[model samples]
Every structure is written in structure tokens, then in C-alpha cells.
Target: MEQELKAHLKKLMASGDVAGIIALKSERGMAKPYLFADASELECLCLTPKYPMASVARLLLDEDGAARFAIVCRGCDERALRELAKRHQVDLDRLVIVGIPCDEEMARECACPEPFPSVVAVGTKLEQWEAEDIGAAYRAMELDEKLAFWKHQLEKCNKCYGCRNACPMCFCKDCELENALWVKHGRLPPEFPIYHMIRAFHLAGKCIACGECQRACPSDIPLMVLNTLLREDMEELFGYVSGTGADAENPLYTKEEMQ
Candidate 1:
């Protein structure tokens, strides 16, 4: 896939299909976004330790077509970009996607249901990861046991907002978490279940299950498992999938859409 990716980069660069490729460049010991124009730099492109590459591209591209580029997208990145575009965060027409499908190992590591983007330019698109509903097991326990289990997990939260920070879909100029009235600032744990419930309800049909929140958590919380369940609930309720299309109805607009 590396060789194929390099070849595609070269082709894109030579044909002036993009201004530059927004991809991960290994620097020192970190893999972060860098504009890769020269095909030689594709050798240093790192696939592991994924960042929200789509967000990087969103910030780089202009809203009025002032800049154009091709991005190296995984399934999550591609889906996130689609979602962002729907929200007017990015201009999709000005960008091209050079998709790199995750192999089995990376797919399993991310625990992603859709490991491959719609555009399969390079690499083999492995089957979706079969994720376990860890929440379901907790739900099956007795009421008291379930309460205790959630209390224990919720107690560990330091109110860092790492989950919101890592989430690509969480783009709001004014967030409820930041409001002193809703969340009461300067309080750790932030009222436990309500604190977490606010985020859970907000992300129901919006989260793409990228696992970025879990990665960013210092406390090693399995936030993605909770998000997966939310996604499932949304699908069951409204029959919608996040980032599937620009015109796709979101659960947030359910009332308006039903009119």
C-alpha cells in the first residue's frame, strides 16, 4: 500500500490535481499534519497514531475556494469531512480525497465498523470491525450493580473535556459544557451522570465512532464504547447514519424534517 500510495501521490502532484497533499509527516517522534508536495516525502507518511486529519484539511482549505488540496483520508477522516461539509465547515468541491483503506490490523485497532472510505484509491479495504457492546453487559446487571458500575466510571472523570476536544464533529462556537449555568464551571466531575449525559445526547447521531475521544483521554476511559451505543440508538430511532451524505437528515433536526 505504501508503494501504491506513493505512486498516487506522484500522479496527483504531476497532474496538478491538488496544491499539496494534507498528510501525516513524522517529525522527531510525532506524526502530525504536513503539506506533502514532493512525492519523496510520502516515504515518511505515518498511518499509525491517527490524528483528526480531516480537521486539519478543513482549516487549511478556504471557504471561498481560495485554496485547493488533496487529502489522505481513512474511513473516519472521509466521513468526518462529509459531516463537516454538511455543516458548512469545508468546501468539498475544492478538495480531492486520496483514500487509504485500513488493513485488518489497523481496522481492529481502531475498532471501526467502516474501515474503508468510499473512495478506495490505495490499499485493501478490510471488512468492518465487529465491535462488542460493552455497555450492554453493564445494562444486563442488576439495577444497583449497574448504578455502582457507572458511578465508579463517572467518578473517575476529571471534567477535562478531552472527549469533546478530540471529537471532530464537536464544532460549536458556544458549547453547553463551557456554560457556567449548564455545567457550573470550576467543578471537577461536573455533576457526574448529567455531565456525561449532556455529551452523550448531543453526540447520538453525530458521532462517527472514530475512537479519538478514547485516545485523548488521560484516564483511559472507554468513551468510544458509549459512543457506539449512541450511534446504534440513533439508527434505531431515526434511521440515520452520521456523515453518510450532505443531505442526510440529522437527529437534531428531526422535528423540522418530519414537518
Candidate 2:
């Protein structure tokens, strides 16, 4: 699969469709995102150890508006890119996506439902996995029980901001989390459910369910449970599934407001 993807990327570069190709390059034993402009460098290209390629792409695009690139994207990566484009953080017209389908094992690891992008350039597309609803138990709990659960989970927070830093969707320059009026500086655990509730409300129609927040949290807080529950509620209430496409209007606002 790696070889096939490498070959496809080389062809794309050779065709002069993009200035470079953004994909993971293996150096020694580490894999990181690298822009491959020369076909010779394709030999070092790898597909493991997923980094936030969408975030990297946004940075590159911001640095050079005229530059065009092709990105090797998994399902989540593509979705993130679409979300960024919708928010005017990226110009999708300047991008050529090279889609790669995720295997079942990778799907299970991330608890991802759709493991493949819109188009597959390499690797066989696998069937979508039935992701376990991680919020089931929490949703089943009574009102007081739910409060107790959140208190226990949120109390472990050390105000590390790992979850915020790792989230691809958290690109606001003036973040509500950092505002002293809301979260209060120099305070641990962040004022009960205030910090987390604000975050969840903000992400109601925007979270792509990449699981980066939960993975980055050192406190082992099951952040995805809250995110997943909100995601479902957004879909049910507004008929909006975030990151699916760039053109879809956010149902949280009116058409006039969007303009």
C-alpha cells in the first residue's frame, strides 16, 4: 500500500499538478509530515503514525497563498481539511487531495465510523466500522449521577491545555478558554464544568470526532464521550454533520447570519 501510494504521489508530482506533496516521511525510526517536491524523496514516504496533516496544510497555506500542494489524507484528515476550508482557514482550490483508505484496525483504534475519504487513490476501501457509542453509559446515568461522573473526571484536569492544542478545529486566535472572565487564570480544574461545557457548546456543530482531544489529555478524561454525545445531538437537532463538506451551512445560524 505504501509503495502504491508513493507511486501515485510521484506521478502527481511529475504531472506538475502541485508545487509539492504533503505526506509522512520516515527518517530513522520516526515518521513526520514532510513536503516532497522531488520524486527521489518518495522512497522515504510512509503512511503510519498519523499527524494532523490538515493543521500543517493550513500553516503552509497561510505562509504562501499562491502555493499549491497535494495532501495524502485519511478520512479524518480530509474531513478536517473541509472544515478548515469552510472556516476560510484554507483555500481548497489550491489543494489536490490524495485519499488513502484506513484499514479496519486503524478504524477500531480511533473508533471512527467512516474510515475512507470520498475518493481512494490507493489501498482497498474497507467497509465503515460500527463505532461503539462511548457516551452510552453516561447518557444512561441519572442527572445527579451524571454530575458526579463529570466531577470525578474533570477534577483530574491540571489545566495543561493539551486537548485544546491538539484539536485541529481549535484555531481561534482569541480563545474563550483563555479568557479570565470565563475560565479564571491560575486556577486548577478550571471552575467545575465551565471550561469543558464552553468547549462542548462551541464544538456542537463543528467537531469532526478525530479523538485527538481525548488522546492528548494526560488526565485520561474521556472527552470523546461528551463530544460524541453532542455530535449526535447536533445531527438530530439541526441535521448537520460537521466536516462532511465545505459548502454546507452550519445549522446553528440562520442563512442571513451566515452572509
Candidate 3:
């Protein structure tokens, strides 16, 4: 699969369809985002350690508005790019997405709901994985139980901000999490659920369930539990699924007629 993807990317670069191809390159046993400007660099290209390539693509595009680039994207990466485009963070017109479908094992590991991109340039597409509702037990608890649960989990947070840094959707220059009014600086745990609740509300209709937050959290504070619950509520109340497409109207941002 890696070879096939590398060949496809080499073709894209050779065809001059893009200025460069943004994908992961294996170096020192670590996979990091690298731009393949020359076909020779394709030899080092890899497809593991799913970094948030969407964010890297956005950064490159922002640096050079006229430069066109091709991105190696999984289902979540494509969705993240679509959402970013909708928010004016990226221009899809300047992007040529090289879609790579995730296998069943990768899908199950990530607990991915939709594991295949719209177009499969390489790798076989798998059926949507029905990720178990990890928040089931938490949801079943009473209000007090839920409160205690979060309190215990949140107390372990050391304010590393890894979750924010890893999130593809968190592109704000000035994050509310750092605002002294909400989360005081130099305070451990950031005054309990205040810090997390603020972030949860901010991502109410925007989190794409990429699981980067949970993966980045050092405290292992089931961040996805809160995010997944909010995602469900957003769908149930507004019929809006984040990162599904760029054209879908977000109900939270849409104006309603006054009755």
C-alpha cells in the first residue's frame, strides 16, 4: 500500500498538478510531515503515525496563497480539511487531495465511524466501523455521578495544552483556554470543569471525532467521552455532523427567522 501511494504521489508531482505533495516521511524511525517537491523524496514517504496533515496543509497554504499542493489524506483528514475550508481557514480550490482509505484494523484502532475517504487513490476501502459508544457508562450515570466522574478525571490534568495543540480544528490565534478570564494562568487543573467545559462548548458543533485530543492527553482523561456526547447532541438537535462536507450548513451558525 505504501509503494502504491508513493507511486501515485510521484505521478502527481511529475504531472505538475501541484507545487508539491504534502505527506509523511519516515526519518530516524519517526514519521513526520514532509513536502515531496522532487520525486526522489517519495522513497522516504510513509503512511503510519497518522499526524494531522490537514493542519500542516493549512499552514503551507497560508504561507503561499498561490502555491497548489496535494495532500495525502485519510477519511478524518479529508473531513478536517473540508471543515477548515468551510471556516475560511483553507481554500479547497488550491488543494488536490490524494485519498487513502483505512483498512479495518486501522479503523477499529481509531474507533473511526467513517474510515474511507470519498475517493480511494490507494488501498481498499472498508465498510464504516461501528465504534462502540465509549461514553455509554458515563451517560447512564446520574447528574452527580457524572460530575464526580469528570472531577476525578479532570483533576489529573496538568494544563499541558496537548489537546488544543493537537486539534486540527483549533486554529484560533487567541484561544479562550488561555484567556485569564476563563482559565487562570499558572493554576493546576484550571479550576476544574471550567477549562474543559469551555473547550467542549467551543467544539460543540465542530469536533470531527478524530480522537487526536484523547491521544494527545497525557492524563488520559477520556476527552472523547465529552466530545462524543456533544457530537451526538449536535446531530440529534440540529442534524449537523461536523466535517462531513464543506457545503453542509452548520445549524449553530445559521440565522433563524424570527417567529
Candidate 4:
């Protein structure tokens, strides 16, 4: 698979279809995200347990690195990129997707459905699991239980902003989380559930369930549950599914766009 991906990327770069390609590269012992313009760097590229690729995609697309760029995306990353593209932050036509199917471990880790891109350049497709029941289970909890659950969950927060920083969709230069008005400056451990609640509300309909936030947290917060619940609600209320179609828009942002 790695050989196939490298060959495909080499072909794309050689053909002058894309100025560069954004993919995961290994630096030191840890896997980090980077943009590969020279084909020689493809030797450093890898698909691994780490999902630093999505973060790279976000950075590359947001920065507008090239008019045409290719991303080596798995299921979650593919959905995230599509969602970003739909929000008008990423140009779908400017991006070329090279789908990489997730292994069993990756699929189980994210509970991902459609563990490959809707469009594929390489790799086999995997079925995506429905997270409806997971969302319902969270919603079914008692109010006190929910409160306690979140409290205990957020207590592990080191206020690292790993979740926000890792999220492909959180591209705001003036973030509400940092502003004194909403998040209050000079506070450690944040404001408990409020910090998370603010994040959840901000991501309400925009989160693409990539699980990067959960994965990035050193404390391993189950942030995906909150994201999944809100996503379920957004789907139910607006008949919206993030990244399902090229032009489909999230109603929350669409309302704001109209205003």
C-alpha cells in the first residue's frame, strides 16, 4: 500500500497536476504532519497509528499552499476534509484525495463508518458503523449523571488545547475560547464543563467525527461522544450529514452566512 501510494504521488507530482502534496511524514520518533513538494520526501511519508495527516490537511488547505494539492486521507480525515470544503474553507476542486483504508485497529479506535474516502485512488473500502446508539446512550443518562459524567471527564483537562488545535475545522484566528469575554483569561483547567460546552456548541453541526480531538488529548477525554451526540442532533434536525455531498451546507453556518 505504501509503495502504491508513493507511486501515485510521484505520478501526480510528475504530471504537474498538483504543485505539491500534503501527507504524513515521520520526524524523530513521532509522526508529524508536513507538506511534501519534492518527490524525494515521499520516502519519509507513512500511514500509521497516528493521524497527524488530518491536521496537515487543515493547515495546508487553510494556508492555500497550492492551487492543487493532494491529501492521503483515511475515512475520518476524508470526512473532515469534505466537511471543511463544504464550509467554503477548503476548495474541493483544488484538492485531490488519495484514499487510504483504515486498518481494523484504526476503525475500532474511531468507530468510523466509511473507513475510506467516498472517492478512492487506492486501498479497499470499509464499512462505517452507525453511532446513533452511542449518542442515544449518552442522551439517555439522567441529568445528574450527565453532569457528573462531564465533570469527571473534564477534570482530566490540562487545558492543553490539544483538542482545539488538533481539530481540522477549528480554524478561527480569534477563537472564543481564548477571548476574555467567553472563556475568561488566566484560568487553568479551564471552566470545567463550560469550556467543553463552549467547544461543543461551537462544533455543534460542524464536527465531522474524525476522533482527532480524542486521540490528541494526552488525558484521553472521550470528546468524540459529545461531538457525535451533537452531530446526531444536527442530522435529525436539519437533515444534514457533514461531508456527504460537495455543496451540502450546515444549517447553523448557512443561517450565519445569510445574516
Candidate 5:
């Protein structure tokens, strides 16, 4: 399957299906985004230590929309790209998805519900994941306990923008978090529940459970608890799952929500 992917990428590059292929290349022993133009460069491609290649796609497409490009997408990357397209952050028409199914270990590490992309171009799909009771257990807590949990977690925040920067869905040019009025500039803790709540609410209809935000947090905050709760809320209120489909409408943005 590894050879199959290498051959496929070579074909895509040679045949001009993609002017450039956005894939990971080995650099300093780390896998990072590298644009493939030559078939010989395909030898450098690697996919481990997963970075958000879709986020890289978002940036590249902005610069060269007319050029065709292909990206190596895991399930999370594909879904993130779909949601980004919904916001006009990415032009899907100019891109190709070379989907790669994640292994079971990666699936559990990500806590991903859907670990397989809609299509797979390389590797056999892993069907099972070890489900975590993160959301359900947190939901089972008493109101006071829940409050304490959040307060404790949020107390560790240093006001770094790691979470937002890592998120592929969070594409605001001028973030409200930067505005002194919303997040305030008083102290180390920032604005506490309000600061985090604003971000949580903003991600209501957009978060795809990729766990990038959680991974980027320096404070080891259980941000996934907040996201998983919101995911549940979105599903219950509108039967909406973020990144489920490219064409699915975000109810939060619908005109009817205003009324």
C-alpha cells in the first residue's frame, strides 16, 4: 500500500492532475508539509507525526486558486477541509483529496469517531476504535462538580492563542479574543469563563473533533470536554454534525436562528 501511494502520487504529478501535491516530507527527522512538483521528490514524502495539511491547503489555495493541487488527507483533514470550504476559506474545486485511512492507535489518540475519510487512496481501513467516556462521564457530573472542573482547568491558561491558531475551522482575520473589550487585559487568567466561553460558542457549529486545539493547549486543558459537549448540543438541537458533509448548512448561520 505504501508503494501504491507513491505510484499514485507520481502519476498525479506526471499527468498534471495536480500542479503541486501538498504532502509531508522528511525534514530534520520530522514530517512537515512539502509541495511536490517532481515525481522524484515523492521519495521524500512521509505521513507520520500528523500535521494539519488541510490548514496548509487553506493557505496555499488562497495564493494560487487557479493551480490544481492534491493533498494527502486523513479523515480529520478531509472533514476540516470540507468545513473550511463551507466558509469560503478553501476552494475545493481546485484541489484533490488523496485520502489515507488512519491506524487504530491514531484513531484512539485523536479520540476520533470517524477515523476513515469518505474515500481511501492508500492503506486498508481500520474499523474499530477504543471509545472513551470523556463526554458522557463529564456530563454525568453534578453541576457544582462541572463548574469546579472548568474553573480548575481554565485557571491554568496563560492567554496564549495556541488553541485558535491550531484550529483549522477558526479562520477569523481579526479575532474577538484579541479585542480588549471581550477578553480584557487585566491579568494572567484573562477573562476566565467568558474568555473560553466565547471561543466555545464560536466553535458550536464548526468544531470537527480533530483534537488539534486540545493538542495545542500548553495548559493541558480538557478543551475536548467543552467541544464534545457542544458537539452533543449541536446534534441534539439540529441533528448537525460538523464536517459530516460539504453541503450541510450550519444552523447557527441560518436566518431562522435569528428569529
Candidate 6:
């Protein structure tokens, strides 16, 4: 699929359709995201474990040097951009999507049914994954159990802020997490579930389940599960999926839109 995608990208570039292609490359110990400009750079375009290429797409768009760009996307990333486009944060018409399908193993790892992008280069399309009640298990646990679980988990936090920083949909100019009132300054471990819950609540309707938050967590908390579960509730109760349509408004802030 990488070769096929490379060929497609090469064709697009040959036609001067895009200025650059943002994809992943296997380097050092892990797969890292990179932008490939010349055709020769496609050899480095590897597809693998790392994902949520939407943030990289946003980064490329922010660069004044990048006029048009293409990104290899999974279902989650594609959905993220769909929502972002509605906010006028992205110009989808000027961007290209190279779809990559998810295999059974990958889908199981993510507990994802809709693993592949709706649009992509090559692969067998599978049935959309239903959003499961993963949180029921979490919710079933006793409050003390949940608190202890999070306490242990939060102890492992390095205070890197990578989870917040790596999110594509988290574009607040004034992030509440940083406010001294909400989260005290210079506090390590950050006062447990408050920090985590605050972030999760903020992402209630907007999180695209990209799993970047979990990947970014040096502590390896299953943060995506909580956020994704809340996202499901938002979808069910409000009829809003974060990255579905260009104009799909989140009901939380748009009380008028809800009416």
C-alpha cells in the first residue's frame, strides 16, 4: 500500500496538484511523521503504528511555505479534519487524503470498528466499528477503586503536557488547564483526576478518538478510552460526531444550534 500510495502521491505532485506530502517514516526506534517533498522522498514514506497524522497536516498548513499538502490518514484523522474544516481551521479542498485501511489486529488494538479512512489509496474496506461501552467497565468500578487507579496512573506522569500539546483538535488559544485557578502552578502529578477529568470534559464532543492523547502520555494511561466514551455519549445525546460533516456543530457551546 505504501508503494501504491507513493505512486499516487507522485502522480499528484507530477501534476503540480500539491506542494508537499505529509506522511510517516520509520526512523531510529519508531515511526515518525515527516513531510516528503521530492518524488525520491517517497521511499521514506512508511506506514505503521504511529497515527493521528491530522496534527501534522495542521502543522504543514500553518507553515507559510506550504500552499497545498496531502496526508496519509486513518479514519480517526480523516474525521478530525472533517470537524476542523467546519471550524475553518483547515481548507480540505486544498488538501489531499491518502486513505489507509486498518487490519483486524490494529482494529482490535484500538477497539475500533471504523478503522480505515473513508477515503484512501488502497486496502479492503471493513464494516464500521460500533462505539462500544468500554467506559461501563470503568464506571462499574468503585469510586475508591477509580481514585486509586487514577492516583497510581497519575503518579507516573512526567508533567510533559505532551497529551495536550499533541492533540490536533485542542487549539484553544487560552487553555484552561494552564490557568492557576483550575490547576495550581508548579504542581507535579497535577492533583490527580481533576487535571485529567478537566481535559476529558473539554474534549467531550470534540475528541475524534485519534488516540494521540494516550500515545502522548508518557505514563501510558488509557486516556483515550475515557475521552472516546464521553465522545460517544455526546454523539448519542446530542447527535453530534466530532468529525463528521463540515458544518457539524458541537452542542455544548452551540446551545442555540441545539434548539
Local distance difference test, per candidate? 0.81, 0.88, 0.88, 0.79, 0.87, 0.79
Q: Which wins on lDDT, candidate 2 or candidate 6?
A: 2
What's the C-alpha lDDT at position 124 in model 1? 76
Q: Which candidate is the best by lDDT?
A: 3
TM-score of each: 0.90, 0.95, 0.96, 0.89, 0.96, 0.88
Which stretch of 10 consecutive residues in model 3 shows the poorest summed lDDT?
A: 250-259
lDDT by residue (84-145, candidate 4, tens digit) is: 77666677687788888776676767776556777678776555454334566778899999
- Stretches of candidate 3 off by over 4 Å are 257-259
Put down candidate 5 lDDT per residue, 156-241, tens digits, no spaces.
99988899999988889999988888888867887679889999999998998889989999999989889989988999999899
Clash totals in order: 0, 0, 0, 3, 0, 3
* Rank ordering of all candidates by TM-score, starting from the highest: 3, 5, 2, 1, 4, 6
TM-score of candidate 4 relative to the true fold: 0.89
TM-score-superior candidate, 5 or 6:
5
The predictions' CA RMSDs to the true structure, in order, are 2.2, 2.1, 1.4, 2.8, 1.6, 2.4
At residue 11, give the lDDT of candidate 5: 82
For residues 133-228, what per-residue lDDT tens digits would candidate 6 score against the true structure? 567788789989988887888777767889999888887789988898888889887877678888999888888877778878887988877887
lDDT of 1 by residue, 43-126 (tens): 887766778888788778744366678888999999999988887888888789888887777677777878889989997786
- Encode model 3's per-residue lDDT on 116-184: one tens digit a residue: 789989988875467777778887999998898889999999999999999999999999999999899
Model 3, C-alpha of 98: deviation from truth (Å): 0.7
Query: Candidate 3 overall Cα lDDT vs. reference?
Result: 0.88
> Which residue pairs show collisions in model 6?
99-120, 113-129, 114-129
